[model samples]
Target: MGEFSKTVGEQGENLVSKFLDTIGWVGAQSGESIDCCKSEAHKNPGTNGRKTHGIDFFYSTKSQLQDYTLDNVVMSVKYTDKPYPSNPSTLFKAHLKDLAYTIECYMKSDFRTDNNDEHSMSGIKQANDTGVLFWFTNDKDSDQDVVGKVSTIQLEKSLSFSSIYLVDNSRAAFIYNVIKYVRDNFSEYSFYYHYTFSSANYKGADNERYGIVFPVEYLVSNILPFRLINKDTKKNVFCLASREQFSEESINRLLYLASDISQDFTDEFIFLFPEYDPLHDNKVLMKAKRLVNAKNRAPNIKVLAYNNDFRGLVNE
Candidate 1:
């Protein structure tokens, strides 16, 4: 496949899109169904082939009222290897106009899609509260120094959001790429979900998506399994249950989650934490863990104190 001749920044946007989906963020396109971990190469379609101006990657709650999950994170992905000039003024102006348009749409309730799926003017309202996330490669150092100044410009102009962040890469972001990379390299690591096409119910339905989890049998047949890879070894031997709360029956559901996988996982290790009470329910968890492993389906179990925004903690 020939790669698109996109700018370094455009390439960065594509990378961020993939990262977003892996971390549970769905892409927001004008007239298409939102998908996770899907990448769209940039192509100039405007006057003189200028890159289109709008939300690079917009995410929200997966629930029915899928609105803006977070304010626009005008991504500034820098390529340490490229000789591109750092133009803060140009960057700020572009993002500000983008935010302005976004706010304008929200005010008119026009952000809602024709399918009424995502960014339905539910999560974001104003630009003052939206922050920008900057990503840099190893060589593009200096925090770009102008970031602080640009952020002030954003605050002064919008009076809405003034948050700024910089990261070479987050663990969650790392895991996001690793899963796909590994899935591509090995068929053993490959997994897929089977869902009948759906677009009607918005209760738990994602807009214009194929899978809606309708049939009871779909529980065991279609949903994708989380392949929690150990960062050190780059292996999915360890798994963590991220749910916050769990009742007695919930325990059975959790057990079946790991066991129901089509692939054999007798050697997998699963960890979880009770919702409100973080470190408190080992006895109960152990009982459930034992029941799951009783059939020689043996998978290690433990209670975890999951901290940070990173997905399934690496058991280092």
Candidate 2:
């Protein structure tokens, strides 16, 4: 655990592969030479290119438009800044030994599929395996020792992860400051935002697709974006998307300012429009669908349509 903590845990696994490429995960490298050794005998994808094995990210999330499949989301990334081993089963035995050989080679691969059009990969691998443990850290000041003995249901019923996204380190800078607040307010077209590993029971704002809330006036403005990113002092914020709302009462005043800070058990809400925020002539996605059909609707206060600057939809 040296070498600058393994390069800050490999840059916190490249910010967990850019937060799983903003959410729609799509082949985010590191199968470690195609599921690296277990005594040779690996390599899929036409004998070489397929890669993807136990963890360190190996994705796929598009069941339609251009179709996709492979996504058991096995993960493992730990970047420390010292102070954590105060005996919590010694950091859960090094996180179940880095997720027992990539979940024992993804439970002896096979993921069966005779092309029966696999049911939209239901809930991204129900229990077959869906691990995640980003857990980064700028260390706000101790106390984060592997999330103070956290336990995703005893580490997913004793490993083989079916769901575990402890992305710490102030939630990796509040999802990298909401993709740098849409790459600094749109900075000129080219957009694509996603950060959902599943969860959208909508209608009550309960779409845990990468859950979020962060109130406190998004850190006194300026760049809070909606606050809730304080890894001891990592600090997070939001609330600024006024470069030109267009009209129609400024898209109902940005959907009455996001339903005046919604919260139906908080699950999703990261509003920030600028890169040419056009709400007027009714088109900014029809003013975000009239602010999700205004009048106390708060349909998870989301306003997205196209033009995302995440560059042609996350490839890095």
Candidate 3:
């Protein structure tokens, strides 16, 4: 297992490096300047000695054209070897938080200077106004045919980032063109990946996302209502709880709470179950299905089996 793990890790890192090189090649072809940073200051050196930092490919332009500013293109490379778990919470929150922090710090520092002069700050300021492109790669296990996976991050949102995953090789050319567009036409917008958790939520995990505990009734009542508050929104709420905490009676009670809340605000309710073969002794899946199919259902309810490959839907 250790040897296999090492191979997986190295493969992931290699894919990320190649992706960065591709970005550099595309930037150079378009007459853009590129720099790659290798520093422990950008990475979180927690208990593990490993240090990782931002943008394996950092890019800037030599000439300005249209609204495109030459200083706005930046790219980061991330490599992950582990298989994505069935549930989002299964991934370590600390690791994700540190990654987000490193990116945030890198962006701020990339454009900051001590001189603060108009011309000097202009270059840094223009760069700050420009958005960053993040290329994320993960190596598949031996069973899978793909050598690597690629994804793009959009950093337009203030508190949250958005990402779209693409298959390897297929989108390589398109990725370069988009980077060029940001450099010349849209230097003011930042692009980032919208991971399951946001930087703020991850930083304040103990107080916000994973730390607080609520009664089963309170949890059911609040989740969908909070989602409904924004009509036309398709926000996903990821809940993590031990199956041991659920019972037929408790499940029915929670269903009742949901039904009551739905009367005030009507919306579709969909519950996703893990796709992998059953391993735990608990009957959480069975109970959840039963509750959703109950005769007293008020709002429309749909139950979906989970897909491991699906990227997270939650912005935070």
User: Candidate 2 on 1-316: residue-level lDDT in tens?
Assistant: 4687778877777766766655435456564423433433333334543345445664433222111223344567766666555554556556654565466656555532311235444433222344566655555674453443564324334344344445455434444555565655444433332122222223223233222322111211222233233335442322334333234555466555545443322324444433333333336555566556665454543443223455423311
- Runs of candidate 3 with Cα error greater than 4 angstroms are 1-10, 20-55, 62-76, 89-96, 107-125, 129-316
Q: Relative to the unseen true structure, what is the C-alpha lDDT of residue 162 in candidate 2, on a scale of 0 to 100?
A: 43
Clashes of each: 6, 20, 13
After TM-score superposition, what is the CA distance of residue 223 in candidate 3 from its true location, in Å?
Answer: 34
lDDT of each: 0.40, 0.44, 0.34
In order of appearance, the predictions have TM-scores of: 0.35, 0.26, 0.30
> Per-residue lDDT tens digits of candidate 1, residues 62-147?
33223222233333334333322365556555545444433333322434333234445553322222323434443443334444
Candidate 3 local lDDT, residue 107 = 44
Write out the backbone clash pairs for model 1.
21-37, 128-160, 128-161, 129-160, 129-161, 244-275
> Pick by TM-score: which candidate is best?
1
Error of 3 at 3 (Å): 6.9
| Two-way lDDT contest, 1 vs 3, winner | 1
Model 1, residue 296: C-alpha shift (Å): 16
Candidate 1 residue 282 C-alpha distance from true site, Å: 21
Residue 214 C-alpha lDDT in model 2: 26
